[model samples]
Target: MLLPDLVRTAARRSPHAPAVRDGAATATYAELDALADRCAHALADLGVRPGDRVVLWTSKSIDTVAVMQAVLRLGAAYVPVAPSNPRPRVQCIADGCAARLVLADDDLAGLRTRPGQTLNDAAATPADCAFILYTSGSTGAPKGVSISHRNALSFVCWAAEETGLDASDRLANHAPFNFDLSVFDLYGAFLAGACVDLVPATLAFAPEALTRFLFEREITVWYSVPSALQLMTADGGLLDGDPPPALRVCVFAGEPFPIADVLRLRAAWPAVRLFNWYGPTETNVCTSYEVTAHDLTRTRPLPIGQACSGDQVWLDPPGADVGEIVVDGPTVMLGYWGQPAQDGPYRTGDFGRIGPDGNLEYVGRRDHMVKVRGHRVEPSEIEAVLATHPAVAAAAVVVVGAGLDSRIHAAVVPAGDARPTMLGLKAHCAAHLPTYMVVDAVRLVAELPRTANGKVDRAAVTALWAEAVVRG
Candidate 1:
């Protein structure tokens, strides 16, 4: 089925049902369907055609979602860039993807209302490009990951089927449209004829606001990086004040969930099904692990589980303890936008191993290892051990310099009022990791910096550390 068909099918099944909610704004399936039609007319008037790529440089809103549907309805792919990006950056992405047009907030609002004809849905096949999602260019310029209709549906269909989502399920969309995590929010929810509550960027890091939204919105399924959940539970008293009876599933990806945090959460929300979805943006959730009670007992980080979305996942080098994760299947992207086509199995820069339970265990990213004092160091190894500390709600390790001059620095978010002293955290690392891996310095933060996708932003952390040193 075409990606746009999700909305059309859902609207036919329940036209009057609540389809999307953002702040006080809401749209029913019928309204969303009509708006998409009008928006499609607007795009068609602008010369958008099949196989063309348009950039939706707008914030997450009911309108933006409608625009996305409109783009698909025309058989034109949409390239998503963070709305916060400046004009130059957006234009760069637009130029990079060779976008036919770049639509901002004003375009759809003004044009959709004055649209003329009810444009027919484009004759798009499964292989047609659906959208281009750009990476959070922390290292350098953002590269768009070109996703096909088949590539996305492989995962969306799997998610809806696996979760048993239906009209009654209220899915919380925490990620921005530019993030791949939002695919399930838009398509998966629509595929299941479910309502998706759009959490605004304003509440992205506001733990208290996020905590309240969960309870008040009666979110049944939640998906985001682990850091957001950690913030909500730790500082916002997510579970302290009331019982969140409606929350049934919590899906996290983008980064590892500290084992200690998982145990605490599992104990609190015993009935809530937890899933650790694993994949980079290019592969859109190739593997998934349902959190078992047995997982809480294991000391290691959570296993990324077996392949899903009709994808085959394996560690390269076959029998090695850990190696780069590789994927070959429907969900793998066609290729980077404006780059060479992915010829075969995509070698994910991430490293992992098949655990004794036959699940894939994440062994940090291949790029995560660094040379500190000429000793190979995995910052995540230190971060993992630090996460085990009673007073540390979250922890991150970063290398501050180059070669022999490099220093390992740690940033921590303390658990509530019980802040772990720098010396105490260092000692904890010393006890758990090798001498070389022990951090040279530690800094406490209310929360760790997060990228647009919600993963801990290591470069931002490094910058913050460096800025402080310069000030000193």
Candidate 2:
């Protein structure tokens, strides 16, 4: 079943149940179902046809969820671009999907530069293209990943079944609509006939606001980036008072979790089940591992866990310590939208290996590894070290300080009152790493900027480096 089926099911099963929450505005299952139908009808009026692509360039809201379901219902493929994305990048995604329509908020709604007509309503689907998701371009140009209705149905059903999600689960919609994580929030919620709490993009990084929202709403399932959890766990004092009444499952992805931070959070919330999910946007959560008490401090690094329900995961160049991860399953996208077909398995640029326990654990991006003073350094290695320190709330490592022989620099977010000195951090790294792998400079910031998808913005960090050099 496509997303529409789930919406219809929720309406039938519990029409009066609260289906979505976005700040003051809330919609019951019946109301959400009606809104989606109205939006679908509106789109049909706009001449949108089956397989037509539409770009949703808006912030996360209950309205955004309705728009997504409306598009899928009409058999139109929705291509999502977060409002935080630069106009040029948004244009690149819209163009890549060959979108026939574009939906935006008041600021962007009037744009007529593209060919597609603006959607005033939602239409009905004929089972054509369901959505197109774009993944980061390590080779320089992003690729549009086309996913069909059948593909989405398979994964959503699997997720609902595996997670034991039901109508009682209140899933937090923290990830932007563009990110695959939203799939778990929207489709999974509808599949389980559960309520979805829509957190605005601006409020997502604010620990206090997020904590209050979760507690007040009694959110049962929390899903977001590890960095966000790190911030909440470190600076927000989120766990100081009574814990969230309903929090049960905490799912993290989009980046690696610090083994040290994981241990701390586990101590803080002994009852909450934490999971480390590993997959690219091209493949929406192909594998996940539940962090058991035994595995958390198993001496070996934590594994990404086993593959999801029906998904198949394997490492390329078998037996290698690290290699590109390959996924084969219904969840895998139908290839880059406009790129030529290359035979064989889908190669995720992410590098990982099968642990001795036969589980996958991510290492770092194949391209994220950089040569510094002729020594290959993985930014994650330095970032992981920084994360373990009591003072560091969050950390991102990037190549900074010009010249072809670029020096590694770190941008760290320090925890309150625990401002560790830059020299101290450098010395800390020196003890654990080689001379060349140490960060040349550590710039302590309040927080690192993040992409719409919640990963640290490395490009923005690099830009800050350039700005620093110019000012100096």
lDDT of 1 by residue, 348-428 (tens): 888888788888988787788899978978888788899999998888899999888999998988887887987888788
Question: Can you write out model 2's per-residue Cα lDDT over 162-263, one digit (the tens) per residue?
Answer: 678999999999888777888888888888889888988888888888888778888999999988887777667776876677899988988988777787
In TM-score terms, candidate 2 sits at: 0.89
How does each model score on lDDT?
0.88, 0.78
Which residue pairs come into collision in candidate 1? none
TM-score of each: 0.96, 0.89
True-structure RMSD, every candidate: 1.7, 4.4
Residue-level error in angstroms, candidate 1, position 35: 1.2
Give the poorly placed runs of model 1, Cα more than 4 Å off: 115-118, 137-139
